[model samples]
Target: MWADKSYTEVTFKGCRPTEPASNFDKSVDIQLYTAGFGDKVGPLKHFTKCFELSTSTATWTGLPKGLYYFKIVKIGGESHELKKIDVDQVRVDTTLAD
Candidate 1:
């Protein structure tokens, strides 16, 4: 997802109970990247302040918007204990500052 303007904060909720269940059972590192309004994404620019499977939520603040995407790292357990979750299990939502 892309934000049109700078945002004070952004939040990511990890799982969707409504969606089909998967073998997701571990904390993950949410890798955030940007492309400066272009299609090419830059290197690993930031990580969420907190990443946990227990809470199923991730967040980062002070983000300048253009184009962005998230990569969930260390799926399953920290050492990749559990099986990989379905691709459908991942979801992204964004709200720009008013």
Candidate 2:
């Protein structure tokens, strides 16, 4: 999601894959970064921060306004997989307040 103005917080709704069975017992990491940075040479070079969600919904605060992107990673060792978020099941909301 792109934020035209700085926001104190962003709300991320819980999401499930189209094929829930594929998730199994894996836990995924929700990572945030600047736009066009998530796929750079070094994945962590443009890293911002990581979020841990205890519930279906999560709110991350104190982020600067700008173009941004998210990376969903399935937790595992060296073989961890990068998962794509199901846009249909997920909702990202940022304050429209100016």
Candidate 3:
């Protein structure tokens, strides 16, 4: 999860497979969805972005201020959702002075 005044960049860390033999070659897929509008309200949902992680750390940037749903997909032997994240109201600080 991440929040910033100017922009939002969510950083995710990669974890080692529990069974190295079975999950060694697996890859991470990130999917972002807009939950709703105004403090995470409403039911109008939409897909926002998708990313494939190829490094130890992955970052998702340029996100608008709203509620977001994330799904981490592990693709290898069998594709499955590894985790889910819900980000509510990503705030921006427009009052910061340079």
lDDT of each: 0.43, 0.42, 0.38
lDDT of 3 by residue, 2-55 (tens): 233333333333334445534345344445455543232222212232222222
Which runs in model 3 stand beyond 4 Å of their true positions? 1-6, 37-55, 81-98
Candidate with more favorable, higher TM-score: 2 or 3: 2
Number of the top lDDT candidate: 1
Give candidate 2's TM-score.
0.48
What lDDT tens digits, residue by residue, belong to model 2 across residues 16-84? Answer: 333463453334445556675553111321112222232233444556556766555443211235443
| CA displacement after TM-score superposition, residue 61 of candidate 1 (Å) | 1.7
Put down candidate 1 lDDT per residue, 20-82, tens digits, no spaces.
345444334446667553343323223222233323434445565566766554444443233
Q: In model 2, which residue pairs have backbone atoms overlapping below 3 Å?
A: none
Ranking by TM-score: 2, 1, 3
Candidate with the larger lDDT of 2 and 3: 2
